[model samples]
Target: MTLELNQLSDQVQALSATAAERLASLERQRPAAEARLRAIGLADDELQGKVRAALRYRWAGAIPAAEPVDAAFPCPPHPARANVLAADGSQVYPDRHGVALYYLINVGSIAFRHGSGEAPRVASRPAVFYEDADLYEEEGRQKPVEKIDAERDRRELGELARLAAANADAPAVALLDNGLLLYFSLQAQDRAEIKRELAPYLAHLSALRDSGAAVAGIVDRPRAAGVARLLHLHTLPMEALKDHADLFQQDADFRHLTDGALFADRLQPGERSALFENGSPANLDHFQPAGHSVFFFYLNPGPAGRHALLRVEVPEWVAHDPARLDLVHAALVEQCRATGGFPYVLMRAHELAVVTVAERRELEQMVVAALVRRGLSLSVSHKAQGKAWTGAGRRRYP
Candidate 1:
């Protein structure tokens, strides 16, 4: 057998014990985290001063907006007539051993018009890249997976922009199945690369904003510790913060605590936490200047006892405008109500975008037929051929 389950019994027992201990630790820390969050005053000039000072050291935390840090705003009334547009993207990465050196990205989108009772609009846009420039970087190296993923993300946002522009007459909320900030900056080689990657994304954000649509990036079961970091920073004295260089490191008080866990209890069913500006360097450096600084809040699109935590990220413009912000919050809650906890539109978009293995094989077969018609000899590598032949087998234990 490639892997024997019997061999993992002892390790599995130890892992279970470790998880139990971590849960105990999480329970012990939960109350203190909640208390600290509830105690912070939004207008505390001293606290804001401290956070601003800590920002200089690249502290990854949450900055308070107009709402109180402990505020739990109930879901606003959903607009009687509104548009909820969502887009999701999937990709098939290039396989070197396959018939062709090409990758494909397909984006699926849905435009659900509330109160209209009309059938929702759906679309799936697919693009295949085979050109040398599309496959290779400036130095002729094959493009990394991150670059390709960034391209998919760009297309997803661009699709949302197009959808939003077309539905500008009504109150609309455009949703993405990710964070608003593009993570490509972390892998960027230089400032130029960062700018190049962000230009198109920023332009799309502008387009969405100009189209009078509120845009948001929704993350389910988020692992972000931005709020926890803020609570940890609050515990430190100003004197210690001044002396400590790496002030953002998690201490014993709140190690491994996430914002999702922190707000799970505080936010009741169909409620959202106070908005906080993200203090990441990318937000402060590039996006903020372009007037798209990202702000996020925790939400529980719930049914009474169960907790379904989500982190909803919006730009500065949406956060400041009352109507747009309300539309985003209410539209999400209404959308989630249709599918238990998560938004129905996002689920449908993902289902439409996903590429199955059978579909991939059919695509390869079509490529082979095209080559054969042109009298060109094209075949998979020897290893790929052998693997295909032996792919199906039953596991055996030794």
Candidate 2:
């Protein structure tokens, strides 16, 4: 009994010491966290006020109706044909410790002009544009394998900007598969690197806005707006949404359902969706250029779970001629077919649409075959639709 008492005493003492240390550390950090809040034009009292207001609002369960968009905008009989360019990037890496090591297997950009009836032109030369495997090492023991930090992202944006600038005088608009802002937060070193890298391109976007040239950042997901609605329903202040509480564990299940099971099947067993994290309000804030205010569109899913044509009318400053936009859409469809029926977002002067799962699988197979014919060894997994193909040592075309 005496020995047991002694052991208990020691454990109690140690726990007390640990608690004291934690309390002291928290006290020291409190002032700094508050100072950061203030520096960022926010304060504790202000935050509480917003949270209180959010709590007072009633929750609305129904999905909000989308506002009607004007599809037919008046155009001059001889509207100047604006060039449309679509760019996308793909990375491949070994699934093991090679996580951080990625082969930028492809960084392709396709450009097309209206009324040409020709296929969209490939911008990156086959040899010059593709980058070899680049090693990105992290600082600590628990480092990230995918080095999608701000610096690397910024470099990518810089390259895209240069491409756009080279063709600046071509009376064209640049289409990016992702958002304009390449980086999310500047709090971390990697994130800050991304910010620095994208700064030049953002400035160029500003110039385009001022020059009355149309440029847009197209995204396919609607969950972002859904999260925004959840925040509104919960009466959480917009500022608090920056912390992305709605994307936390409490709401993760609902958010997952929103994406539907189609894409979810593609994820590895333990892997989580990166969409919510990438499309968070905090990340979207970095897209602001002097004259450009980013606009988001929500495309509705059809009865067959396919995306019907949904139009996101561009602001007049970034609008392209309708005929030119149609040509670009046609090229995108062709590209989808070429890529093995891989579905892609179709960007038009008036709207954005989601590519169906059927189309996506078809595209993947087509692209894989093309790569095989070129003598490159390739393997593809298409389990999302309950289908997959494996190529053995021999590069046989499927």
Residue 343, model 2: Cα distance from true site in angstroms: 8.9
The clash numbers for all candidates, in the given order, read: 0, 20
Q: Compared with the true structure, what per-residue lDDT tens digits does model 2 show for residues 351-372?
A: 2122335644454556567777
Per-prediction TM-score: 0.96, 0.43
Candidate 2 wrong stretches, greater than 4 Å: 1-80, 94-102, 117-119, 125-146, 149-160, 166-171, 181-194, 197-204, 207-212, 227-285, 289-293, 299-306, 309-398
Worst 10 residues of 1 by lDDT: 242-251
Query: What's the lDDT of the predicted structure labeled candidate 1?
Result: 0.89
lDDT of 2: 0.38
Candidate 2, residue 99: the lDDT equals 11
Q: Pick the TM-score winner.
A: 1
Provide the overall lDDT of each model, using Cα atoms, as 2-decimal numbers.
0.89, 0.38
Cα deviation of 232 in candidate 1 (Å)? 0.9
Q: Which ten residues in a row have the lowest lDDT in candidate 2?
A: 64-73
Residue-level lDDT of model 1, residues 1-398, one tens digit each, is: 34679999999999999999988898889998888887895638777877998998888789888888989999999878999999999999999999889999999999998888899999999999999988999898999888889999999999999999888768999999999988786566587888888999999999999999999999999999988888878777888888766485666888799998888888988899999999998888889999999999999987666669889999999999989999999998888887877888899889889989998888888888988999989999999998877777665678
- lDDT score for residue 216 of model 1: 94
Instruction: Give the number of the best model, judged by lDDT.
Output: 1
Q: All candidates: CA RMSD in angstroms?
A: 1.6, 17.5
